[model samples]
Structures are given as structure tokens and as C-alpha cells.
Target: MDVAELTGTYTYRSFLNRPEPVDDFNKLRFAQLELRLTAEPDGTVSGELVFSEGEPGGDTIGMDMVGRASGASPFAFTLTGKGRPGSPVADFHYEYDGVILRHWDIGIGQLMTLAGTVLRAEDHGSGATLARAGQTASFLAVKRQA
Candidate 1:
């Protein structure tokens, strides 16, 4: 699938805990975020994100990314973001591969989930499958600063 057409705003929640190196930290919660995404024909996606609830950390994150896919194959993407203020931005990438969308003989049986959550596949009138785990189910958005 071409990455250019996949562009929209999404509302989401962000949950996080301190890494193993550090302990006793609180589990941070970021919710009710208004995130927008724009994918380009050249496999690049760029956009901005804003939060409507929780904390201000998610108020906006910068995202300049890319995704690649071949016919009938699962799509893959790489995205990164930086929180507002003193928040440090991080870069992460994941691929959606070998997904199955089965219903009455696997009509559209293959799906690709990015980073263990986001699901992308052929929207043909058929049943869809999560296929594998580790696919991110949430679409995150971040804005670019001028």
C-alpha cells in the first residue's frame, strides 16, 4: 500500500513507566490527545500532535517519518517525536508484516501492525486479523516546530 493516502487526526492515550534502570518512578499517563498524521507518496509521513487532556507533555510532538510497502506485503514505518518544553524526543520504528485477514477463505487475510499496535491492511469487504502480536494499536501524531 502507498503511504501517502494515510493521513488523519487521531485521539489517543499515552502510558509509560520508568525503565528498568530506574525504579520507584510513577507511571505517567497522557490521554485525550489530538494527533494528526500525513503520509507522503515518497513513503514519508510528517505532522503534529496536541493533547486535550492529562498533562502538557503531549501537547505537541514533532513527527517526520516514512513507511514502505510492496503489493500484498505488510507495510512498515518509522516514526519519531519530541515532546514540548523540556521533554526529550525519541525515535522509534517498527514494521507490520505477515498479517492474515481471514473470514470465508482469507478474503483479505494479510495485515500489518506497526510497533505492536497500529493496524494497516486492505479494507476490502472482508474480515481482518491482528495476525501477530507486538503491533502497536495506536496511531501517534506530533507537530513540527517552526
Candidate 2:
């Protein structure tokens, strides 16, 4: 997949693992994410996922995360992330394998531009799905605040 294809801002609600409670997935609500993906000729993607405390208009109370994905295609890729959640004591990092499956047939395929599902971090029994109408819904394009 090309960077321009996925070139846009996206909002997402992630279930953060509460390290103090043995890595439990807690509902991180009203959180927004901005992803800028650049496709490299080597079939790898370099990007940054910025996590904000509230909407873009609000103050950034949390940390900003950065990660990279490498794969033959964007549908199925591996991502590794590391960042601090606005705290000096806590650290955030994880690796996940994601695949874009057909919504009807469930067959592996290239992720659809502007519309698709991404399964990230499946360690918690089931991976999180970031898609339309989900708890985490992000605009694929950059939002220009007025």
C-alpha cells in the first residue's frame, strides 16, 4: 500500500494496559490518534501515532507514541511502538501483527483505502479493532481546526 493511500489523520480509542493492575486493558475513552504513514520503497512504512488526551482542541495531557510497520503490504504488517504516557515512571511499547481480512469472506487481502478494519495488539485474548462506528472512530484525513 502507498503512503498517500493511507495518508490522513485518524481518531482511535485504545484499551490501554494498566500496568499496575497486572496489565489490564482499561477503556481509554475520548482519546484521539493522528497517524502519518510514509511508505518506503522497501515495502516498509515509517510513521508516527500521536495520542492526545482529548480532542485536538483540548489540551494534550497524555503521551505521544511513535512506531513503524514492515511488511509486504499494509493489510498485513508488524508494528513496534515505544513512548511515555506523560509520566516519567511509565513506559509504553508493544509489537503486534495485523491483517486485513475480508469483512464478508474473511480472506486476507489488502486493506481498503478510506475504509477498513485493523486488528492491533491481540495479546488480550482478542485484538482491538479500529474501524467505523467502533468505540474508536478517526477521520482518515487531517482535520484542519478552524
Candidate 3:
């Protein structure tokens, strides 16, 4: 797929590890993730990622990101966060290495899916105390329809 195809707003979800199995008592809970992507002619991709609700009483976070398509790989790209210094998220940055997936879902119909791994390259705010830097998580995101 062309890089432009990946440009749009997407709803995203991530799992700390693999998700837990679902059962009668275990209902799935998901954070709200909004990814807005735009691609340039040179294959550079720019976007914003808004993440919320993963932790109890945690504040929603938004970060700006920039990256380019992986060499000769139209389906792949690596994006890094660009948090401003002194901001709430300034100390922490995330890097997402992802690829577009073409799949059909019975419930969601034809889907423009982006799946990959995300890395917390730096720790931010109070989280820095936890030393969570260099941690990685798997994520799945679907482009929203216009």
C-alpha cells in the first residue's frame, strides 16, 4: 500500500503484554487512542497520538511524532515522539514501528489496520520514577472512515 493510504485518523489499542483471556467475569477494557497521520511526498510521515484511560486516574497524553517509511517498504514506518521540553510529556517519548495490514473483519467489515510494537524510549513525569524507559508493547490500530 502507498504511504498515503495510511494517512488518516485511526483508533488505536495496545496491550501491556498479550491481552488476558476473556471470560464471563472478565470484560475487556480498552484505552482511547487517536492517531492522526499525514504523509509527505518524500514519504515522511507526521502525526499526533492521543492516548488515554490505560491507568486509573491517569491523565490523557498527546504527543507529536515524525518518521519516514522504511527503506523500500511501503507498508512499514518507524515514528518517534517529539515532546517539547518542560511539558508534561517532555521527558518521555515513544517510538512506534508499524506496518499496514489488509484484512476483512466480519464485524468491522473491510479494515485499514496498522499493527506493530511501540517502545517507551524515555520516561516522562512521575513515570520517570518507575524507570519504564525502553519498555515495549504491542499495538493494533484501525483507520477511521471519513
Candidate 4:
């Protein structure tokens, strides 16, 4: 598929992979995410991601992402926190590796989906390093209509 096909807004959902005894603190973090992406002619993609709890009057966070797309199935991207210095998420960084999946949705007809694994590349809050990252999650993002 053309990289341009990925330029749009999408609703994203992710589930963290915790150990057997999952506790309240180890549950999924964000309630929802909105991804607004723009694909360039050079196969590079830049975008903004907004994360919300899906609750009335709840707070939301925004981050910036940059990555490259391939004509084949593979795509990789990294998300960097846009928070101020010393903030909880100031040093947050995540890397996502995924593939574009095309399928038919009963309600939306043909649907384009992004399915992947997310790695906690950097997490200052947890003092995570390359050898001992914080956590991993699986994510799925579906492009929204114009």
C-alpha cells in the first residue's frame, strides 16, 4: 500500500503485557488515543498523538512521533513525550513496530488497521535502560474517516 494511505487520524488502543498477578497499578494506562499522522514523499511520517482517559473532565496528554514507512508490510515509529522538564512523562519514549492490515469490517466496510508491539524504549520514571525496559504492549489502531 502507498504510504499516503496512512495519512489520517486514527483511534488507537493498547494493552500492556503484565505478569501473571496483574495489580491495579500495572493495568493498562491510557483509556484512549488519537493519532494524527502525515506521510511525506520521502516515506517519512510525522504526527501528534493525544492520550485521554475517556472520562468527563479528565486530563489528556499529547506527544510527537516520527518514523518511516516501507512499501512492504513493515513500519516502525517512535513516540517522544512533549511534557515539560521534570514532569512524570518528560523522559518517556516508546518504539512501535507494526504492519498494515487490510480487512473488511461489517460496519465500516474496508478497514485499514495497524497492529503492532510497543516497547518502552526509555522511561526515566522507572529508571529503565535498554537492557531493562519497563514494559511492552500490543496495540491496534484503525484509521478514522475524514
Candidate 5:
């Protein structure tokens, strides 16, 4: 997939980490993450992911993705954010798995729950996956039209 394929807004909900309140998904309510990515021809990838609903501290954290990716090679980026008292950053890695861009952040403890799958719109369909701490909860997302 390419930049044009990724230029859209995607909203996703994840039931990460268990034992709270299990829905039809069977896992507890974790949170919802919304992403908007703009890929530039100049090889600059930029996007933001918003966290809401599950816990505190998510809203205070600001995350922005900026990186580069090539054919078959993984998309490598840095997520700079106000994760702490002073702004800190983490590395994000994603790969196009033929179907979706499976991604994960370096993860700074409980600071950021940043791992998910992004599926670009194709002939078949578009969707996503949300997981946390090696546990993949159920997720579904849609691409909004511009």
C-alpha cells in the first residue's frame, strides 16, 4: 500500500487488558483510538492517534507519528509526545502484511498503549486490529471519505 491508500481517518475501539467488564468481545473495556495519517511524496509520514474512554492520563498524552517507509520494508517512525512531565518519544514500527499495516510502538510502560493494525481500503475491504500487552482484543474500524 502507498500514501494515497493511507490518507483517511480511522476510528477504532479496543478491549485491552482484561477483567473489568467484558462485552461481546469478552475482554474488558480498554479504550478507543482514532488515527489520521497523511503520507507525503517526500517520504514524510505524519499522523496522530487519540486515546479516550478507558483510563486517565490518555488525554494528556499527545502523540504524533513522523517517519519513513519503503516497499516491503517496515515503516519506522518516532512518536513524540507529552508522555511525561517533559515531552518524551518512542519508536513505532509497522509493516504492510499484504492486508494491513501491522504496527506497534516501543511502548513506555503504562504511559502509552500503542499497538494496533491498520488496514487500508482495498478491493476487498478496510479494517483494523487493536491489541495490548501481547493480547489482541477485537476491533473494527472504518475509513472516512474526504
Candidate 6:
């Protein structure tokens, strides 16, 4: 399918594969995400990602997103979104790559393979070379029907 075809809501889930079992490792392992986006003809992207974690009535947070799609066959894309807002201590930087599987019958819903690194704004640029790097994770999500 084409990137333009992905203009709706999708349920996204990613698994963390970190070498060290840090305190935040559990966060990535036990979260469910929902992405609602509109793909423009020019490849512009606008969306919001809702993340739910913990128990049934657990915490849920929203992130604002804007991105662009590239390539034709694989429909690779880059998304830059912010979560937690002005609260520096609670904020996060999300960066990821996504590829909608060419085949649909392989998984539960429209299969999408995703991988990316998530870090704090401070853990960037030349200064960050000495600081600890960000965390990386990869997983698959299925696009749900409208």
C-alpha cells in the first residue's frame, strides 16, 4: 500500500530490547500506543499519539506529531514528536522509522514494522557525546480499521 493510504487510526506496539534492564526498561515493555494521523498528498504528516500504560485504568499520555514520508516502494517515513511539553523533567523526544508491510495477511491487522530511538532533548548534539545516550527499541503494530 502507499503512504497516502495510511490516513486513519492505528494501534501501535513496540518492544524494548535493551542490554541493561534499567528502571525505564519496564516502561517500554508494557505500553500500548494509538496513532491517529492524516497523510497529505505531499507527504506531510499530522497526528497525535496516545500512550497507555500499566493497569486497565493506568496512565495515558498524548504526544503531538508532525512528519514527512519519503520513498515510493517501501514508503519510509520520519516522525518528530514531543511528549510531556514544557515540563523539562517529564518531557521526552521521540524519533522513529516506520514501514508498512507490503503484505496484509501476515499479521492481525495492517502490519507495520517500527524501530527508533527515544531520548531527552539534553541527550543530543556535541555536548551529549560524553553524556549517556538515549534508548532504542523496535516493534510491530497493526493498523486498525476506521
Q: What would the per-residue lDDT of candidate 6 be over residues 1-146, giving only the tens digit for each residue? A: 45677677777766766566677655657346887778888888888777644357854466777888864877777777676553322355667677665666655544444434443334433454433346566755566754
Task: Please report the candidate that would top lDDT against the real structure.
Answer: 3
Worst 10 residues of 6 by lDDT: 116-125
Give each model a TM-score: 0.39, 0.40, 0.74, 0.69, 0.42, 0.65
Name model 3 segments beyond 4 Å from true.
19-31, 52-61, 70-74, 104-108, 127-131
TM-score of 5: 0.42
lDDT of 2 at 7: 35
Count of clashing residue pairs in every prediction: 20, 1, 0, 0, 0, 0
Candidate 5: tens digits of C-alpha lDDT, residues 8-120: 67664554445555457634554466766676765566676554333465433434545553434444333222222233212222222112345446633322122343322
On residues 1-146, what C-alpha lDDT tens digit does candidate 3 reach at each position?
55677689899887666456666422433245798889876789998887543357764457788998743544788899766554565676888998887554554577788888888887655644664677777888888899
lDDT of 3: 0.73
lDDT of 1 by residue, 65-123 (tens): 33442223444544443334433322222322222122244545422222223432322
Residue lDDT tens for model 2, 49-137: 56545566865433343334343343554445445445431244444344433234565553342322223332222236322221222
The lDDT values for all models are 0.39, 0.40, 0.73, 0.68, 0.42, 0.63
lDDT for residue 120 in candidate 2, whole number 0-100: 31
Regions of model 1 farther than 4 Å from truth? 14-30, 53-72, 85-146
TM-score comparison, 3 vs 5, better candidate:
3
Q: The CA-based lDDT of model 2 is what?
A: 0.40
lDDT of 4 by residue, 1-113 (tens): 67777899899888866556656743765336887888876778888677543357854455677787776645444343343334345566777777787554565576678
